[model samples]
Target: MRTTATSRPTSVHLFCGAGGDSDGFRRAGFDVVLGANHWQKAVDTHAVNFPEAEHLCVDLDHYDMRKLPKARVLVGSPICTEGSPADGIKRPKAAPTPGQLSLLDEGPIADAAWERTRATAYDILRATEVHDFDAVVCENVPRFATAWPLFHWWLQGMAILGYRHQVVSVSAAHIGGENNPHAPQWRDRIFIVFTRQSMRQPDLAVRPPAWCPTCEQDIQAVQSWRNGRTIGKYRQQYDYRCPNGATCGHRIVEPYVRPAASAIDWTDTGIRIGDRPHHGRGPLAASTLRKIRLGLEKHRVPALVAVNHSDPGDGRAVPAHASPLATRTVRIGDGIALPAPFITEHRGGGSTTRAIADPLGAITAGGNHHGLVIPYRKGGPTTTAYPLHTIATRESAGLVLGSDALPEDIALEDCYFRMLSPREHLRGQRFTDDYTVLGNGGEQTMQAGNAVPSNVAQWIASALLEVL
Candidate 1:
């Protein structure tokens, strides 16, 4: 459990998905109230988990902040799919080429969604300021902070409200473990922390009681984060890794293990081992896969596309990168590297290509299959050589790769064979063992996906607590 500095607790939350953000503040000894989608299930989840506080299932846009409970800290994370750049915009990227027009520059649905989402965020920030929350924390995809215009307005609003603030993109890798090993993986998330300005810079920011950043092997590193943006030191990501090395490969993906419902890690209620995949798992169901893909396209997040590759092992098959039309090399991560990509958020959630590789004829775009492929490389069909890292030259190979692994593995509950359960994913998000997630039914898995990772909330809460 984290030590709380405040004599009294803080209270505030918005877009409070299953209480991931709220869990942190509460852990930091804050009295948190929640606001989020009016879905009965979500509201119930919040109420059940944090019964000591209020959980309002009202639209933040319609609710008046003045009428809401006032507390020292406020926090939130809006729906990311609607605003993420990962979703392809209806607008074309870059300047228009000849007769074509930029889709984002012209489309209706795209423009409406973008404007409404950002506007909503701006309204909430303004309202929070008016209500006098001492500190504010907003979480979102790293791109969300930069892609929208309204965020600039937030800075202005903070200036008007007499608060100093800063935004940093942090990742789950900071909380990684040997079983997790998601370092080297990059899934940039933006965390914005702000504190009310007091007496115009006369007060020195509270520095932690610590020893040194210049310490030796026998000592632990001491550090601090400030809302005033004193990023005089290296960023967190840099601090987490070996500066001389290449990417660590593992990154933050969807949480796969559920945290304990209590602070103890070894209780009977602690995470039970379940199915998680290694390599060789195939795509999830079609509908579920589509949601992630469509979500990415709509949000403008980039997708991998196979351009040219060589398959030295296989004789001649490959499939298209999830990318539409044709593009350069498709993007994929080795399982040993980054945090695994998120499983579909909702059940039966769809595929967005986990691994894309090319080999001799295996990785060609000729087939409808996804994942690794062996493509026909040099020479002709009889004499060609394929590379393991890619598959391209020709699109068609005689057979598909190990897609059967998915069903068989998901069917079982063994090591590296099982599909990631909702519980595991929640754990990945960093939820502590305690935050309760109430699902609609008795199915714990559903509840896990629906809720936010408690650890992420902990990070935010810890930062907010530091504002004292």
Candidate 2:
């Protein structure tokens, strides 16, 4: 076990999906003594990455907390799907009954299984009741705050157990860089810390100014709040703007926010849209085709475009080179589009994509839905430059200048499309290159989506270490 200036602090992670949090804690110099989860595959992945840590693949809901080993810190990312807005389930309008803490005797929630899953928060209480840790950190979606009353009740339970808690909202993109690792994706989450000792809240404010390619100047962030509450619903609490009055929109200037282009493998240019048979699907969906065309028109060059298949309004094409990818979900929502006739080689290669214009989006537990689009050139060997590149071969390859072609001139026959690979998704999640993710493509994607950005975890762990 790795030791710090004080000593090796032990941590136990509950609902440790693929060990993203575990990995981060380890990096922050904590001894991750145990990781517990319900899914066997998740357990196996955690085991593979953290062989020294003991793992339990049992349902946390039914498992006896008394059996868990004692540790200095406890970390948990309870099942959040039931409480997430992405699930599409209408949340109850009424607050949960004051004293009815048991899911079996639920008053407001109707779904028993969802109640059980949501009750996982109470599992932290259960664990604390079993063993008194120095501190406890619980991570969940920002929307999890919507259950204010129940959340307060959980805090009250902690207070009764002699632990004071603080709720802080943070984004992975805003935290790490320089000497620390940073996730390419923009994921906003709330970390509630329960400490037995009194310590000021950890400083989770945005770290430094980011370069605004649009404004061509370094921009800072302006935090938005109203009457001591966050300005917008869900993840908006983590967003900030430049106080310097930069005209480049009020987007958060995250210098630490890495781009999606860093995660893409240009050599893996997917199959041509025209060549691949869609079987009975009848050519790509009109919506998808329209997105591609729209992307082409918007970019006006051989560019990387993300075609979102889920919500049309949300599905607008983004220049892959200039924008961080939108959140990755379990369902295949976003797809990549490229103008056609571009040759691809089996060996990996780089593209001429530029920095992402927007912040990276959150990754969910479903699967990789982000897609890429590339422009295809008709003839001759093409080389990587500006926005496009052709397959590398023994023959000399040069820039194709496909941008000269107007969007109107580009036809459906001129593009290629494919989903982003799982490895790329993992990169966006900030997992190490040596990290092993076991499973098929879909499962791997699911694990990546579910994972906490390890860098974010490391930041949180490092902060907790100072206070612990």
Candidate 3:
């Protein structure tokens, strides 16, 4: 640890699965004590990665908080299958689980995940209040707070305490990660950032100023995010650190994505194009397209680079990697004078690790996948539809993307097409090739596709930390 603010004494974690948020909080300089219930792999991973922090495997519903120490920050990720809207139209809490519904089946994994999360959240909140920690950060499926009744109660309960909840949605990339290189894997989630409002300085406001463009987009996207949405639409950059936390001593790597364009929506300015200097332009960029005389191409990108206009006496300085198109499989570029718009997310995941698992996807080499297009309609007869191989819709000219996604441009078969593999999807999500991309084939593929691009994360996190 850098012995920074995260090194404080009061930090604690409940239902901390897989330690994603824990790592961010740790990087932010807070000590972390992770707690979880049947998440064995996650607990093991947390211990392996964060040995400095204690990992308690005991169930929070029964665990004694007095025996444990306190911390400044509290983080939790509640499971959402049961309470989430994605699971289906709401189910009454009283509905009988397998244990109650049948004498034969005793275990219900979905029910267990949901109930445990609730128990853990309540326990953490109460215990943290007991300790009077400075802040509490609760993370989970974005809709969990809105869909679950008990979640609503927890929010109200937290309000009664001195802390008022400030729900802020963040991308994994902003906290420091890589961007997906190829396809867009949108993972938007809602987090409840709670702190003692009175204790927080006015400048530490989590809500960005009204002028921040990203904040405006987030506000606009909330409604699109409500009901079930699509998967793998947007992805942001994220990072993996080196032995030292300082960037001066580190090498940063990320995916080679279709970099965001610098062009702004000029419509807002109300300035006529004719009034502008760059006029009589078929999209100034298109006019400058390098035409290959004999199919031999030449030119700068469609305005990827804009020459700086300088006085006759002053020389215009070109950037270091002034490109001829970078070839690295995974490369990240800082937003030039032009700040990139956030990768826009659709109704569902919204370009973060904010995933809601869908067991209904096709059987890939990995596990099942969830997506925009779903098969197997409820109560519908066995209609004349075979298993789909391609997520494609033919447009007037050629092929355009379909509900989910089609197979690779080079895949041999059709109906046999599984959604993009994790590696390809990782590439699609804008993660660099150097990072040790992980997942056990299908599961690994899902993991990579579901993760944020590290480069993007580093940029966003750095911006956030500077404010801190």
Candidate 4:
């Protein structure tokens, strides 16, 4: 723990789940002096990792920020269950989505939790007014900004506090880029950066200002694939291009698409070329046809690599990884399935037979029967929500085995897969190895899944320094 005098710009973290945000700021030289969270286990974990910071196990609903030591910087991640799209709360002002309805079934426990957690957002305003901090950072799901009156309230509150704020959606993976090999996880979050009128600097944004040219072409190819709107008319346009000529357009589609699997699923029966499914491009080469057929049967994601002589010309639509273009459809259920390396199998206690759960379901904070099943000689799921704690011991890390060898192991039947350990989760969040998770597997898993990746926090911290 590094101690600092009052003269240094100090930071206090609210809702500090396992201190991932503070760890990033600490890495960037911020004196993270204090933190407060409701979960005792998480607070204990935060204390273990950030020994010097004052950790308080207090609920934000009734907690007062002024009672604590004052600091120049304030950072927080308000409870997101009520605002996260994943939780089925699509619109901020609307009642809980059906998915969220489960919480309401438990009477006061769920209802009260929702009410109290929802108010945590206003706690930021309270901290700003009471502490007179020079800057405030509130991190949460992107929907937090547009969740009905919530965004309006945040904007109005900051205005009352006489601070100007900017909301930027940043990707942790993009910020880390190629330099930080440890920071490849795809995590996107909305950061509301507020600064006192005194600081002078341009606002910060990690999103690329421009893309490569070949990437632009790829984007057009994807846009045209959309049956509804054309790429030119689409509002959110990316201008970046591949630095290399057409030969290397990998970067264009890299960030948007998950890695390829050996097999894939196509949307239409008749193979059409060009962006529109109707526009025909004569006959594809026999080799191209063979690869497409093989990819579909083998469950492999088609390649979007650099265009080669054997490749179809630019602007032509081909069977490939699911793209932003393919995602845009008039009908909700209409979409193609890309190749997957493995299938996610939720473990069951019974013998002989078990069922697979939703592939992209929320990774709850426990080691229950949930795990992934990697295909033989193929790959695994693209999503990172699955943790490494599928097995009870550390030796299981990176150990893929057949289910028949251990007949009782239901998650691994015909395919082979391994659960990611808590340490691996920390790495995905860009936390240093020394950072400790002080609890059982469930508590630790929750901390990792719910955390705002530290890499993003570090980028925001560095940006905050410029304004301060």
lDDT of each candidate versus the true structure? 0.39, 0.59, 0.34, 0.48
C-alpha RMSD values across all candidates: 15.5, 11.2, 18.8, 14.2
lDDT per residue as tens, model 2, 1-468: 233566789999998877888989999989888988766677789999899999997778788898898788899975475444423466653333332112222122222223333236778989998888888888887666654447667778999998987776766655675556567666777777788855655655544444443465555555655446752332343445556564756554433244465566767766677766653223554445555666556554444332221221221235556552322111222334333322111111222222232334566543244556665666411223223222111011222233444234555555766656778778878887799987766667767877888888888888887766
Rank all candidate structures by their lDDT, best first, as comma-separated numbers: 2, 4, 1, 3
Q: Sorted by TM-score, highest first, which candidate order results?
A: 2, 4, 1, 3
The local lDDT score (0 to 100) that residue 60 gets in candidate 3 is 71
TM-score of each: 0.49, 0.72, 0.45, 0.59
**TM-score of the candidate numbered 2?**
0.72
Clash count list over all predictions: 85, 28, 63, 23
Worst 10 residues of 4 by lDDT: 259-268
Q: Write the per-residue lDDT of candidate 3 for residues 1-468, one digit (tens) a residue.
A: 122555344356676544445544554444566545454444564576667777777667676667666565565655444343433476654322221111112222233333433334567566765766566665555556555567767877887787776554543322222331112332445566666766642122222111112121111111112234421112222221122224223222111112111111111222122222343222211111111111111111111221111111111112325532211111122111111011111112222211111011111111223211111122221111111111111111111223232112211111111122334444433444433433244334433332333333323223333433
User: What tens digits encode model 4's per-residue C-alpha lDDT throughout 1-468?
Assistant: 112454456799988877878987876668888878777777788887778888887777688666877777898976475444423455544333221112222222222222333236778888888887888888876656554355676678887887888776654544543333224344556777888777664356444322233433323122111334212111132322334445655343322211111011211112122222234233333333333334234333332222111222321123445332311101112222233333332322222111111112223332322222333322322321132122111112222223232222212222333334456556557676778887655456556766767777877787777656
Q: Which model scores highest in TM-score?
A: 2
**Per-residue error at 93 for model 1, in Å?**
18
Error of 2 at 408 (Å): 7.8
Candidate 4 clashes: the total is 23
